[model samples]
Target chain A: NAGVTQTPKFRILKIGQSMTLQCAQDMNHNYMYWYRQDPGMGLKLIYYSVGAGITDKGEVPNGYNVSRSTTEDFPLRLELAAPSQTSVYFCASRGTGGADTQYFGPGTRLTVL
Target chain B: DQQVKQNSPSLSVQEGRISILNCDYTNSMFDYFLWYKKYPAEGPTFLISISSIKDKNEDGRFTVFLNKSAKHLSLHIVPSQPGDSAVYFCAGGKDTGRRALTFGSGTRLQVQP
Candidate 1:
């Protein structure tokens, strides 16, 4: 079902450059999330959405933004990339009704120069 | 401020032995715990999960145990195989379904033959 798919598996951005990381799921999940994993650290939540048009900030939402225009899509936007933002980004989704586990997409490795 | 932590960065086990991975969480609000396994360059796949209401849940060769009072949980892989070699991540989540999960720094497990 293409559980979750992300675009541009790898990207390199310069300081101050902007980009949007795309995430889509064909599973028809009601919940979608964006997370970043830095070396030697756990995955940190950046943003999430419960449904289309409903998005909220997560633990590390400072340098990112997100929008859930449709149930199938949730995109994360980086306004100004920085070295600290260089990390492996992942997209995940989950269905409702007591499903506690999430399905993850192959991560996008970003490097900011 | 790390809500979840995996004390061990890596562990090596002989094939056909048991592999025990531990995780601890600081947040008392976490009502569910999950374990995921990831291969290099691939996304994480759910292994097992235990709810706060229950202390243990078993799935085939994998089992998850939860200790609510201590805020600790663990995943056990019995008769581990070389194919089980991967990074294991433990995550905590609330039952609300609206909140994103807090993940632990993954433990790289190497099941050597």
Candidate 2:
């Protein structure tokens, strides 16, 4: 299985611009998450989905949105991107079991100027 | 507030030596702790995990120890190899609800051969 995969390995956006970060998992996980890691900072959850059509805000959800329309896909949208949004974004997925191990994608490096 | 913290930004160890990485969490609600390792340009991968009920868990050359009194957890790698060089992240989470993990800033380990 390809496990989890994220599109746009690297991207740079101007202030006020908008874009979507795409994520997909072949494992058919019931949970998917979006997280951003700033330089010298830990990864903070932006949004997550328990299942298709079920999304929730996380630790840092400002300036971002997410939707899980299918069990295999979860996409993150950034409206009016700001410099503060510059960071490495990671996508992860996990099964519904009690185990806390989340499989992560290669991640997308995003820069907003 | 930062729920999870990895105080050391980086660590270096000689080949065949032992490497110990530490993590602390502020929330007592966190019952599950995990460690992830990431290579440059790659996403983080699951290394090991420990539950609150267990004081330690071992897998191959890696071991995780949890000290509930101190609200601390650690990962130990015996006979560290150059191939083990990577950024290690420690995370904590609750077993109930959505089970979202709070991650540390990460510690870059350089295994010198």
Candidate 3:
């Protein structure tokens, strides 16, 4: 399986601009997550979805939005991107059941100026 | 508060030597713990995980030890090789609910030849 895949390995956006970070998984995972890692810092979850139609906010959900319309896809939207949003974003997924190991994609490196 | 912490920012070990990485957590509700390895410009990959029920889990050259009473966990790599160098992240999560993992700042390991 291709596992999880993300688009635009790198991108730079101007302040106030908006874009979507696309994520998809071939593993048919029931849960998907979005996380951002700053330099010298641990990853903080931005959002997560339990299924296609259910989504929830995470630790750092400000300036971002997400939707899971299918079992294989979860997309993250950054509206009015700010300089603070310049960081590496990772997408991950896990199969049904709690405590399942999450598989992560290669990640998208985003820079907001 | 930082629920999970990997205090050491970096560690180096000689080739074919053992490398030990440590993690401490503050949350007693965290019943599942995981370790992930990441290379530069890549996403973190799942390495190994241990549940509260089991104190240890082994996979090939990697072993994870859990000390639930002390809220501590560790990862041990035997015969560390150059290819084993990467940033290791410790994450903890609850076994129930939609609660996601809280990751610690990664520890960078360099296996020198």
Across A1-113, the per-residue lDDT of candidate 3 in tens digits comes to 89999999999999999999999999888888999999999999999998889999999999999988899999999999999999999999987776798889999999999
True A-B contacts kept by model 2: 0.76
Error of 1 at A17 (Å): 1.0
User: How would you class the docking of model 2?
Assistant: high
lDDT of 3 at B108: 98
Better of 1 and 3 by lDDT: 3
Model 1 lDDT vs. the true structure?
0.91
The DockQ values of the predictions, listed in order, are 0.82, 0.85, 0.84
Q: State the lDDT at B40 in candidate 3.
A: 98
lDDT: worst 10-residue window of model 1 chain A: A93-102
Q: What share of the true interface contacts does each candidate keep?
A: 0.80, 0.76, 0.85
All candidates in order of DockQ, best leading: 2, 3, 1
Candidate ordering by TM-score (highest first): 2, 3, 1
Worst 10 contiguous positions by lDDT, candidate 2 chain B? B92-101
Candidate scoring better on DockQ of 1 and 3: 3
Candidate 1 docking class: high
